[model samples]
Target: MACGEIITEPLMVAAIDLGTTFSSYAFATRGEFKDDPTKISSYAWCTGSQPGLSLKTPTCILFDKVQNFFAFGAEAEDKYTELAQGGGPHTLVLL
Candidate 1:
């Protein structure tokens, strides 16, 4: 250790839960969590269908033949449905 030295680090921590049907993400800062464990916050994702926000999103993604990303979650669902109706080629990842 040097007499005059400094160390820098992130002040926040986060996690993601990718489930078979849905996924969610949460985060908390070192100070916020230390002050109160309940300070940890989880976000609600927006959806294209239905009203109001949801605690999680459908675990799905849309891509082209070359694997270029198209959309995720509700948006992906909508886009995939549209493309399917048009008989277009695409890939869907659901896990």
Candidate 2:
């Protein structure tokens, strides 16, 4: 492997999208892709304020006062909201 070089090996492929308002991840095995390129699999996120399932979750990160990672995605949104309502100490980063 070298800079700007492409690898042609057959391996599982995964991707993550961190958007301004949302984030998501998906993956597919090489065989699965060979069968159908559109058959990638992704997780469904559940939010307290939203109905049904969401393929993407809010792009947020929660950290404690010490700056240690605590939660991410929908969990981060929920926890940060809870802390805000209760006036608890926490750090929230929205990407």
Candidate 3:
């Protein structure tokens, strides 16, 4: 249709999955179904990999309170120290 064209013919009902380490989402519509992957990734863009509300949101959420985090899955702690100190790559990247 063109810019001023009207939309006709539509469907209903939809089933959506959110992905691993996360929940799934589903609802109803008035057109086609969206059973594909629309992963949201970061704090930008509403389409193409927004993964913000998914498990692929990258472990970028930094904390700034604790220090010395060298264990597995202990990144939240590690980032805290790096951000709190405001140090350069020498402190966070090298270590």
Q: Identify the leading candidate in terms of TM-score.
A: 2
Candidate with the larger lDDT of 1 and 2: 2
lDDT of 1 by residue, 45-67 (tens): 88766678998988888776677
All models, RMSD in angstroms? 4.6, 3.1, 12.6
Candidate with better lDDT, 1 vs 3: 1
Native-referenced Cα lDDT, model 2: 0.81
Off by over 4 Å in 1: 1-10, 87-95
**Cα miss at 89, model 2 (Å)?**
4.8
Per-residue lDDT of 12 in model 2: 93
Which stretches in model 3 have alpha-carbon errors above 4 Å? 1-8, 13-15, 31-95
**Candidate 3 residue pairs in clash (backbone atoms < 3 Å):** 11-30, 11-31, 39-51, 40-50, 40-51, 40-52, 41-49, 41-50, 41-51, 63-80
Task: Rank all candidate structures by their TM-score, best first, as comma-separated numbers.
Answer: 2, 1, 3
| Model 3 CA lDDT for position 60 | 30
Error of 3 at 67 (Å): 46
Question: Compared to the true structure, candidate 3 yields what TM-score?
Answer: 0.18
